[model samples]
Every structure is written in C-alpha cells, then in structure tokens.
Target: MQFHHHGYVSSDPRVEPAAGVGVNRPDELPDEIDVLIVGTGPAGIVTAAQLSQFPNVTTRIVERRPGRLAIGQADGIQARSVETFQAFGFAERIIAEAYRITEMAFWKPDPNDSSKIVRAARTADDPTGISEFPHLIVNQARVLDYFAEFMANSPTRMRPDYGYVFRGLEIGDGEYPVTVTLEHTAGPNEGATRTVRAKYVVGADGAHSRVRDSIGCTPYGDKANHAWGVMDVLANTDFPDIRTKCAIQSGSGGSILLIPREGGYLFRMYVDLGVVPENDNGSIRKTSIDDIIKQANEILHPYTLDVKNVAWHSVYEVGHRVTDRFDDVPTDEIGSRTPRVFITGDACHTHSAKAGQGMNVSMQDGFNIGWKLGHVLEGRAPESLLATYSAERQVIAQNLIDFDREWSTMMAKRPEEFDSPSELEDFYVKTAEFPAGFMTQYQPSMIIGAANHQNLATGFPVGKRFKSAPAVRVCDANPVQLGHHHRADGRWRVYVFAPDANAAVNNAAIDASTLDDFASWLTTSPESPVVRHTPEGADVDSIIDVKVIYQHDHTRVDLGTVPAIFLPKVGPFALTDHEKVYATDPEVDIFAERGIDRRGAVVVVRPDQYVADVLPLSATAELSAFFAQNLLPQNASARV
Candidate 1:
C-alpha cells in the first residue's frame, strides 16, 4: 500500500470522505469549530486541506455547489503553485496527468500587407528558470477531486460537503462567535437548516460574495466591461500552432488563444467576442460555439478550422477588480469578537483568465492563510499574525488587476489598432513575472520584522521564499532540491548551514561551538516559537524543527554523526537517529551556486516556507526576538 502526503495509504479501508461527516442537524456540529470555510472552489478545498494538518484545530467546510463540475473553468498551474503542490506531495501526480507548456508562439499579421498572418515570436515558456516545475494545463475538476481524496485520507476526519447553502451570517453570543445558517438544497433532507458556529470564517464564495456584502466590504477597483468566448474542442486544422500554446491576432477578426489540454487531440481555445458578428437589427445577441469556430476560420484565413468534437464551452465577461483588504474589521456589534470573517480569491478580486491565474490564485490564497488561522486557533501564534494575510495578499491582488487591465485591453484590440509590433510584443515580455507567481513580495509584518534582519541572504532574501536549487543529501548521498524542503505540517524550520567538519568532537554534525549554540537554543530557548507556545502541561514537539545541510564533499563527511534532532526517537526517551541532516557539497556546492558560502548562515524559514530572517549562529538573542514577535507565550491571553 502506498501512503500519500499526510500518511494515509491509497488503499486504506478506514478512509471516509466529506459524505462521512456525522452532522445531520445543527446540534450535531461541534459548538466551536476552528474554521468555517464558505465556498468549495479551489480556495475552500486548499484551505480546508491545509487546516487538516493541525490536529488541535477542527475545520468544517460547506459548499453551495450541488456537485463538482465535470468540465470546470480555469486550468494551467503556475510554477509557484506547482511548488505549492510539491509541498503538498501531489505535484508529481498532477504533473503526470497534465500537459506541459514549453513554449508560447505569438501570431500576428505581417506589417507590409496586414492581410497575412505569420508566427512573429517563439519564446521558452519559463525564461527565468526560477522553478523546476513548469506551467501545466489540466482539468480543474481533476485537481479538486485530488484534493477531495487527500482530505478523505487526512487524520482530521473532516471533509467538505456540497449542496449546503449558507442562508445568513451573524455573530452569536458563545465561545464560537460566527454563526452560519445552512440548509441542504437538493439532498434528501432538502430545506433542512442548521446553525454552524466557528472561531473564524473565510468567504471564498467568488466576486458576488454574500459574506463580503454582509460584512460591508466593497470592491475598490476596475469593473468588468468586456466578454470573451472559450471552447474545448478536438479540431481538424491546418494551422501550424494547433497543438501548441499560441495567441493569434488576425487582420479582419479578433484574436484567439489556442492551448492544448491534457489527453490526446484536445485543446481549449479562447476567442474575443468581437469575432462574432453583430445582428444588423442592432439587438443584443448571444454568441454560439459555431460562431466562435466561424470566427476562428476567418482569423486563420488560408488555414482551415473544423471541430471534430466539442466537450464544453461558454461565454463570460472578464474584468479587473480587487478589494481594499481581505479581512473584515471587528466592532462592538454582536458577532464581530473572536470569530472574525475574512474573504479570499474571487471574493476579493476578479480578473481576466488571460494569465490562467483564476484557480491558482484562489488555491494560493487558501494556502497562505490556512496555517496562520490554525496557529492562532491552537493558541500557538498571536492573533496579530493574522493581519499579514490582508497586507500580503491584497498587494498581490492589486498587482494582478494592474496587469490584467493592460493585458486584456491589448488582447481585445486588433493588430491594426496597435501603433507598432514592438508595443504589443513588449506587453507579453513585461508581464511574464506576474502570471508565473514568482514576483510577489510581501511587506514587513509582525512575522517579518523591520529591525530584525540585517545581513539577509543574497538571492534568497528575507521576506521572499527560498529560491530552488539542486542539492544532495549527506546521509544517503541522494540528490534534492531546496524548494521541495517543506511539508504541510505547521512547523517553522530553522536550517543550520555549516561547513564540512573535517572531524567531530562527540560525533556532532558541525563544529563543536556552533553545534553547542544550536543545541542549547533548540533544547531550551524560552522565547523559541516552538517552546513559547507549548502549553503548561501539554506535551508537544517544539514548534521549530532543525535541519542541517553542510557545504562539504559528501564522500569525506560522516552523515550518521549528526545531533539527536535529526534522528528518530521512541517517545522522548530513546536514541536519536541521524537521518534528517543532508549535504549540498556533493558535486558543485548548491550553497556556493546560490551565493552562500561554507562559512554558513542560520536562516529561519516560516511554516509557509518563506524566508523569515537570517543570522550568524552566535546571534541567539536576535533569533529569540524573531519568535517573540510572532508567537504567543504559554498561558498568555489574547493580545487583541
């Protein structure tokens, strides 16, 4: 039997899905749930799945959708999102089932005559080489199904339920403040209502969010004004770029985006509504799939377009819109105390699907905030840490809009509308960073302090995620990548990068003095994030986990000599195994390639795996302060 990310075997007989949730009435729900996720799209599933990692916190996810879509909207996983899936231990699964996007071909009319269409440019899909995982195109429904399966096997025993409609949102007086009134829509007990209360509520319910409206939150950006048509078809076409990711602009008709989907001979094509001719009577008319194909034929000109099969298609308006903040402010009003309500994904922003970010962004929003909420509800982290969710994601949301506003305007126009070729091509070149989801940088918050980091690591700077690099382990002499270091577990990783100790005193992983300093902090730092949040009588592993990677030849060093932290121990009273320590000095040192040295640096990585801060091993006080700013001390009351 093969065990997956959270350790449930694929063939496990004990697996129970969301349908196994034992709630048949309002009283059946736990009086206080840790989280109440209001939507079942990419955002809700990712959020619920992430929250399931923390055994101390309970999560309840309810969706209004009657069932999963057989043919859903939004495909194409960005490189950063693929890194996220790698963290979840499912990227390889999706990558195997999805079509890899290698290069994008741009088509435009020749400048001389404006009548002939030609391939203007062919560029590598990921020119920056920032991530090992490339962008991929797969069915959106398949991705959600994987999430559902992962949740079923999770240890938390909570799964998302569909056909449950939220009728009202209110703050009730009790341990759980946020009350969600729900009713089953199409199930056997139709119209049966239940009140589920939670400590926190997240509204990922799309642009028309009922929770956002109830909270008095409003969108503060651009309104949608354009509509586009998309179709998934198996086509018989003479066009050279039929099987490739191509954007073609015709002289007479509007532009079309042809992206090959997973499986053989299937492609999703997006066409501007301007391609469909308007009725001479001047009344509003709906565009059909045949009309889209006709416009594709007109755009191709000499090349023919014939649909061999049609899977699914639709016409929807696209726009650039975003909200001021992601979280709702608290007031003296009845339900706004401990149970705070927040929104993410489409609820916070809406944009054109040109960047293929609709689903990825939604999932990422869930990934970013889920752990933070878990930490707070479990009393491990200060409530102040939650504010960073709004600060970080809102900026990303704005950047998304600014790019979409420009990209959509450019794509909707004809070739003749542009002054020159350079102008249009430059648009694609300049906007590469946003869609790939690599350039997003968060502001300084409680977690990442302004006065803490002085000598940040170059390349992998503080506040940015650690850049990916190829490495090899010292223990097994196996290769590894730096970006794949994290799992869904809610623990911050403190990486001790030390030089190759030619010899060890008492068989330690590094030099005696550095090892002593690290061991002292790891075992007994009062202000350590892991130590600080530990309950008075509760036995829990420290919130921090220590990992060591040396910059020396793997052949020369002793891998088994690492400290007790790297090894497996029976309970708290057994011999430690030396398995977690690794080496990057095997071939060409990965540290050297990434602008670090054998002298080494102590880098702090957040639970989300973003680089929090860096320091010399001797600066233990600075390290202690880093945790004090984010984590709450044991027996401490709410800071808010």
Candidate 2:
C-alpha cells in the first residue's frame, strides 16, 4: 500500500541515469538499438519501463494511433498483476481509481418458483485467499496512461512514437538485423517513410497484427457460433446487485453480466448475442450496439435498465486463438542465426473478453521479457535467457485460450442448452484459477532448471511465485509484507532463512554461533559466482540483494546474539551495505506458517519473485550453479 513519491519530469527528453551511476552508459547509441517495440499498448509500455533501468540498452516503441486513448478496452486487474504493479511502483494510484471485487452473486430463479429471482450462490472473489490484492475493475486506458507516464520518466526516454505507422518488418543480415519500416501520421515528416533497426523486435500490436502475419505466426483456435456484446454505460437499474457484480441468468432471456465501474454511475454490461447472422464466407456478422442494448433489456426483464448515457460499446464474434511462434532467430542461407524478432500480447493470442484477461496477461508478457531482454543487452545474461520469454509465456497464452473457450461458452449458453442444469455452475467454479494469475507456472527452462530442487525444506515449489507473509521489520517496528519487496528490478533476491539467534547448531544450543556452518560455507566459497564477480573489497549487494529471514523472539535476544552473516559488516566483503535482516512477528511465526523449519533454508527468489530454487546451506555447489545459469560471470558482465 506504500507509494513512492517522485517529482514529474518536464518535457520529453532522454532520461539519463543519476550522475556516476553503478555502470557507465555506452559512448554512443549503436546503429542497432537494444530493443524495438511495435506497439504502445500494455506489453510495449512494460517493455520500455523495465528496460529504462538499464540505460545502456536503447529501446524504442512505435504505435499507429494518432493520440493516447481516452477509453481503455479492459477492466479486470488480477491480484498477481497488482502485486507485480506494486513492484513497478504504481499499483496504489491504479487501485485508487479501481473497484476491487470482493464477492460475487449468482442470480437465478428460485428452485421452487421459477418466476422469482434468488441468489443461488455467493463466494469470496478469491475463494482460496491466494493473493494479497483482490480482483479489481478499472479502465485499461488508465492503466495504459500510467505505463505511458512511466515511459516519459524512464531513463531511456523512449516516449512512444504515437501517430507513427508501422509499414513492415524485415530481418536479414546486418548488425541491427531487424528492420522496422514506419511513417509519421502528421507534422513535417508526413507521407514520408523511414527505417528503424534494433537487435531485438517486439510485436505487441493487436490481433489483426501485421507483425504476426509478416513473421508467419498464424492464429489457430476455435471460433464457435457464440457472439457477445460489451458496453460501459451510465444507467438506472432496479436490480439488487446494480452497484455490485452480478451474474444474472434470466428465466426466459439469455444471461447478462452487470459490473459497476470506476466513477459516478458508470457500469459495464455483458449481453449474450446468442447466434449472430453469418457472412458470405460463413463468418459471423458483428452485432450492432442497438441490438446489444435491446438484448440487455430483455435479459433483465423484471428489473429495467434506463440508459441515461453510453460511454463505449463493442460487439464481436466469440473465439479463442494463439500464434504458434513467439520468438525466432531464423537461419541464413547457410543455416546461421539471424537477429531476434518476437511477438507478444494480442499479436500472439486472443480470446473472449469475458474473463477480463487481455490487458492483465499482456502486461505480464512484457514484464517477463523486459528483464530478460535487459540482461541480455547489458551482458548480465546470455541470449539464452531471451528464449524463456516464449517458453514461459506461450503456455499461459494457450491455457488462457482453453479457459476462455469454456468460460465464454458457459456464460453465453442458456441453462437449458447444457446437457444438465448444474453444468454451467460447475464449470464456473472449476476453472476459477485462470483469472487469479497465480496458477500460471513456467515449466523448467534454462533459467529455472536447478539441481535437487524438489527436496527443499520449504514446500513452496520452484516455478511458482513466492507466496507472501506478514512480518515486522527488525530495524523498525513497522509491519512489512514479504511480497511487497518482490520488486521488478533486474536483481535476484536471495532469502537466507537462518535459525533463531538463541536456537541450536550441531555442537551449540541457544548461542550466537547458530549459523557457523552456513557462514563458513559462504566465506570459504570465495571463488563462487558471488565473490568472483564482486570487486575485491566490494559488498555482494552489487551482485544480488541478500536478506536473512527468521522467526526469533526479539524481546528475548538482542541483534548481537545472532550470527554475523545475519548482521554482515558493511565496510567491505559484506553481503550488503545496509543490514539485510528480517524476522517474523512475536504473535505469529511466518516461517513455520509456511511449513519452514527452524533449521532454515536458502531460497532463491527470481526478479519476478517466483521461488526459483531452494537449497541446504551445505550445498554450495547448487547455489553457485544456480547463479551461474541465470547470471553472467564477472568478465562476461564487463562486456556491457
């Protein structure tokens, strides 16, 4: 809930890092910039924002739109996305303008009397309490504005080339192999086309993506006879759940979903179009706005909706689809690797908007690639890390397609259309995990494949995001949620869960020598990646952010009672300049609550806060190897 207060930058200018920052910028912007983004939507903006941190990596975005959108296309903000947004430093501003979904009402006619409406079921928005942030509804336009603001303030200063049109993309032999052709929408450069090149290209363009077709990432999925109408309106409704989320299944008419939006009397309504008329090619014709509202009125037979004003409305044929390829380095005539060209967001996948997943998953796709692309360009990681973007994200895209197919179908069909009456409700409850965003897990990839990963002490599985727990800061009594610090910065977090200061080791009990074994392993492994990369007198914080987490009774013991590793010396050869320490609250043991033991653990948390891998203190090999796989060595990083 905490917000970082920063002054707004005046005018559009290249955002340079602070004076004498950690690393020097490249002397010149290379002919082939680090990355070229093809759209200014959620995915493109996220890519720009993340790469902003590493100024050495030059990035640019081109959008065909002439101006920023006054209205957005999506509304649902999943918990997982909110947490990631918190890390990016803008969730609070977004939350201030959003309606957090707490619970839902499933309205159907009473079983005994089919004429009277009744609430058949009510459940918590997140029934499992899986995430800290609940499902929220807000104009995706606001989300995009925030992202655009971040771009303006970014060190890269690649404010979108809005009003610019992308003509074509060609990747051939050259330093900046991916060539993007573009033209200005207006101004002195009107009617003139130019070419921009980059080491990597991202196509965040919409489903009718020119990039998808240019790259041959064909969209393949089912598009049934179902059609839907969505609208944001200001109206008067007598339905009891007017201000709240309601799934109304009328006795005679089709289903209508009503959700109250951000300000005033604004609300969103989803009306089932049943079956639309087919076109000459047998494709369904797009429904008209008037027909959509007519159906909405029909669905709410008992309670009337008197529309005072209409904000935006759209009607479309329902369908699910995903591209086969996300990224590729095509072979030359002799079968050599070409430059990197990739596609994300709608360019890669599209599905029914009923789930409110388009914008959330799109931003996440950008989040996943942002850091990996930064690492590759900065020489902190090899090109192999870039491959995980497609590997990790494509699965989520496919899963979303499958989920949308069922959820949209169930919501569109009448109760009698199902084989059995209860089938509709059963399917809704079963696939609840899709929208939560927590269930999306990346399979084993070069970044995640680790040794002895399954035998970790804490049962928090690798590939799953690290779950958060409440605890108080040791320095101050302020309460801190662990996930709050799972920042989007490129650095990885190594949480070394140490024993209580008063707890026992092999030969000693209730003493300061509690972490003798772990400390020895750390200091002795000087040739390890951490020590090897760190300057002779530098702290390891430059390499990775380290924190020691435990559940010790602070009242019973002082800071000196704990091992020195928990309280590392700051001068030189220290883990961090600022003490990297944390502990559980006296009223609750956060570690034990998460099935962690007093013996402690070494949990490797990825930049995205996924529990990447865990190891025993004794297994220095596993720890070293894990870092080596994900991060570039000292000499390799110097190439930046």
Candidate 3:
C-alpha cells in the first residue's frame, strides 16, 4: 500500500511499474533461466507470484492448458489461505467475493421417521477462533485469477506461458542444472518441442505429473474403495439446509456434503456413490450426472432437488497418497547433494477433497519452495536451504492425508456404524483446526528454530503461523493487526516488544534505553544478522525488517525517542518510513492477548509469517546465530 516512493501514480498503485525482466518480456520460452515452474495450479501460480518479487531472478511458469482455467475442481478456502492472500495483498477483495461459512449444520436420520433427515447440530466454522480470517468457499479459478493479477502487477510482471506442456526434465552437473523439455500444446508450432535450462525446476503439475516421474518419485498410498460425485449446480431444493453447509446422513440412502457456493444460487454437492467393489477397474467413475442427482435425492429422502444448470462436476474415488520425498535428491544423497528439482501440490501428495485441503496444502507447498528457491538463486542463502522445502512440506502433506482419510471414512459411514448420533459432529468440532489450516507446526530444522525461548512470546508459538492481534499505529493512531503488515516480499521480520510502561504516568515517554541499545546492536554490530546478511549498497531493512510494539497507548508514546532501526530510510530518495512503530491499543492489550512476556520479547518471523524463534531482548547473539544457520553473509560469493 505504500506508494509515491518511485513517483506520483495517477493510475492504480497496485499495478507496479514494470522493471527488470518485466519490461518487454519475451513471448517465447528462454533458453536459460534461474527457475522454471511447471503448471498453473494454485501451487504453480503462488510460486510464480512469490518469485515475481525477486525481479533480478529469472523465473517462468508454464501450463499445458491453452489458457487460464475456466472452472476449478477445488472451492474450499481455509483461513490460512486467506491469511496468505493478505500477504499477497488481496485478502479483502477475495473475502468480499467469497462465500463465508459461519456455521456448518449437520443432519442425520430422525428417530421418529427413519426415512427423513433432521438437523443434528450446527457449529461455528472456526469454533476455536484460531485465525482472524473466515473459512471461505470460493471457486479455485477465481483464486488463481487473483494470484495471476498479482503476478502481472509485480516487479517481474510474471505471466503463465499457456500451451506449454512439461514433457520431461533432467538434472545435470552445471550452473543451469535442470534441463527441461517442453511441448507446444497449442499455436502454429503445436507439435514442436523446446528445450530450456534452469538452476531449479518446480513441479506443480497434478497427480499424473511428468516431472514427478522424471524425478523417480511416486505417490504411494491406497484407495478408500469409496466413490463420490461432486457437482456445482444451480438448483431448487426443498431441503431446508440447502443454502447452509450441511453434512447429511440418511437411514439408508447414503450421505451428502452440501456446500453453498458464492453468488447465492450456486451450491455444490458431494453425493456419496456408495462403496466400490474390490478390483472395480475404475468403473464407478462412469456414473452419470443423472445418477449423481438420483443418489443426491435419495440421500435427501423426502426432500428433492430440481436442477436448472450444472456449472461443473466430477467423479473421484477417495484416495490418500504421498511421496516419500518432494525433491530430486534421493534419501541417501540428501545432505551430500543439493536438490535441483522439486515437486509440489498433487504431484507429491494426493488425497480426498472431503476436508478441502488439496488446494490449500498445495498453495503452502508452493510458498515453501518459492521463498527458498528465491533466496538460494539470489545468493541470499546457501543452496542447502533448498533442501528444507521437502523436509518441511512432506511431513505436512502426510498429516493432511491422514486427516482427510479419517474425515472421508466418517462421511461414508452408515448410520448404524456410528455408536453415537453426535459422533460425526463431535469429530468435526474436535478437529476443526486441521481443516482451518492452523494445525501445521513445523519441527525444528535449519529454517525453524527450537522452541526453547517460546515462553517469551507464548502466543506466537515457534514453527506456527504468527497469530495476529490488534495494535494501534503510533503515528496515525489507527488500530492495525501486526501480522498483516507482513508481505510476500521474502524479507525476515523482527518484532521487538518493549517492556511494559504507563505512558501517561511517564509524561508521554517510557524508558526505552533497553530497546535503543538492542536496536543499535542490530544495526551496528557486525555479529548482527541484519548487518551481516544485508547486501552492500542496499537498504538496512532490505533483508531484515525491524519493528517495535510498546505496551503504552499511541498518544503516550514519544515518536522522537524511538530507535532508528524502526524508522529506516529507503527508496529513490532517503525518505524515513515511520509506519513501522506501533503501540498497544487501549481497547486490546496485544502483549497479554498474544502472551508476550511483560519483561519484553523479540519474535523472529519468517517471510511466510511463521514464527521462527522467540527470544528475550538480551538474546541478540542467539538471534544472530539463528539467521546465520540459513542466510549467507553478504560478503560471501554467490553459490553458482
């Protein structure tokens, strides 16, 4: 949102002035590039968008499709994804257009009338309030559109190269190690082949990924022997909970997961097709739309659906599969060699969509690899950093598969199978966090630090996404969420929470000597990560952004007494950025809400907004060591 630094913009500020590779970008595929991303799904698009921020890095994404997807199979948008949209600068717009799920109604067979379904229980979408964002239901295509727009407006002006199919790829020894073969799926040179080389290649291609095959990685898991027909339709239904998200189970007609879509009239139904027989030979996929409708009506029993139009539909059997690894480097060669190729999204993990995690988890996969690739390619971090992508995300994908397996099995269960009528609803409420995308907690590794200092900021748990809380900006007196200030710019964040103080009693000034000393050490000390990692001639905060949040109210905080680290000067002109400093809102104490120690704490957040580490104000040395584990010193030569 910050503008006027480059120049006065009469047009929309969101549309960044093109620079670097963005200027007069070539239409044809380049012979060489820093990174090559395959597929334009959620994973691929997000990776491209993140790479677009690093204008100096040559990155491109290719899709086999002739153009953008018209309709996407996925629609559920978890809260974590909404938070990511905020970082990419489009959460509000997407949320406004999305169908927010406030409450989910569960239905079961009525005891008096076993043939009819009755509402069992209605629970809030995010009963635990894990995130500020809402659980949304939006078309996957629209989400891709928003990300595509962000890419176009980025400094790199990235755009997906449609009609280019990833035929295959190989990793060799050299600077551009990944040699990729692509086919022209459309256009005058339809049958022609193109060869390109890249330092790294990412496979966001779906289940049948050619890139995954080339890397010798296979999705390993079994099917649930259950089939479901899903469809987005415009229909009139006598079912009272049709417009509401409902999980329906009839006495004998099977079950239905009815989700209301955006635009009011459109809704989606995942009609259970009953269990497939052993060695069915995929025959259940041949179930017709009419058959699906009949099954849906059967589930509803007394109620019925009069379909007017079908937007999109598909038949998928429940399956849970994940690869042992997500990268080209085999398990035996892990630390000895660096990864040159990677797989993400459905390429590495495939599972039932009942929990609506395929797209959400895939997007996170893109983000995980995107930043690591950017850093390593830009010489900000060592090539070893790339290994963490697979290390971290592979575990998360397995967890998703397990969660989806349980949820899918429960959905397919008969009424008599459940010991209690409320069992399904109880499971739904109990495991709400997983579906909301807040259950991921990265274990300690090169990127994620140990949680020894977690007590300093108990709320911002190490390895989890930084839970945002409201705070008032000191300069403007406007209340803001601290975590919302983070963007997908690939820079680290250091939030310094100063000791408690009563600003009014202290005459508009709280003792900040401790904060000033820490800020001076961070900016001037050679051992400081900020001073050690930032490139010469770059802004002080170009690598690590430092911000302070005081317990005192905005009016009582003295702006002049603040440290210079929080007020960095940057852009074409050395203009001081005063928006970094913040104070606790009088209405809500962020420190208490987020469990920050009253004595003070320093929370280090990764570019993706996950809390990397928490430290006491005096543990500046420990802070330096944490970043040193990942980032290369500015004086070090580029890894190429």
Model 2 per-residue lDDT tens digits across residues 1-640: 2111123346333333332221443433234576888888888888877776675677777777777878887888888888877887788889888888887778776667555566777756777677767788888888888777765555655466666777788887666778878777766778888877878888888888887777767788878767768899988878778878878787764887777798747999988777765652534345667777787887776667888888998877777899876876432221244328788899889998888888888988998888888888877787777777877888899998988887887787665577976665566556666787877767766667453645544556678787887776676655677668766667777777776555655655643343566665555455455554543444445456667776664454356654454455443232222235677877667776676655677787777677777776566777787777777666422100
Highest-TM-score candidate: 3
Poorest stretch of ten by lDDT in candidate 2 = 330-339
Error in Å for residue 116 of model 3: 0.8
In terms of lDDT, the best-performing candidate is: 3
How accurate locally is residue 154 in candidate 2, as Cα lDDT from 0 to 100?
56
Clashes of 1: 4
Candidate number with the higher TM-score (1 or 3): 3
Give model 2's clash tally. Answer: 1
Q: Give the winner by lDDT: 2 or 3.
A: 3
Q: Which stretches of candidate 3 lie over 4 Å from their true place?
A: 501-512, 635-640
Worst 10 residues of 1 by lDDT: 275-284
Q: How does candidate 1 score on lDDT?
A: 0.73
For model 1, which pairs clash? 171-335, 474-583, 530-543, 567-577
Model 2 residue runs over 4 Å out of place are 1-32, 110-117, 277-286, 329-339, 418-426, 450-459, 501-524, 534-539, 560-579, 635-640
Look at candidate 3 and tell me the lDDT of residue 624.
88
Instruction: For candidate 3, write residues 494-600 as lDDT tens digits.
Output: 99999765432225544546677788888788888888898877778888888999887788888898878888887778778888999998888998899987778
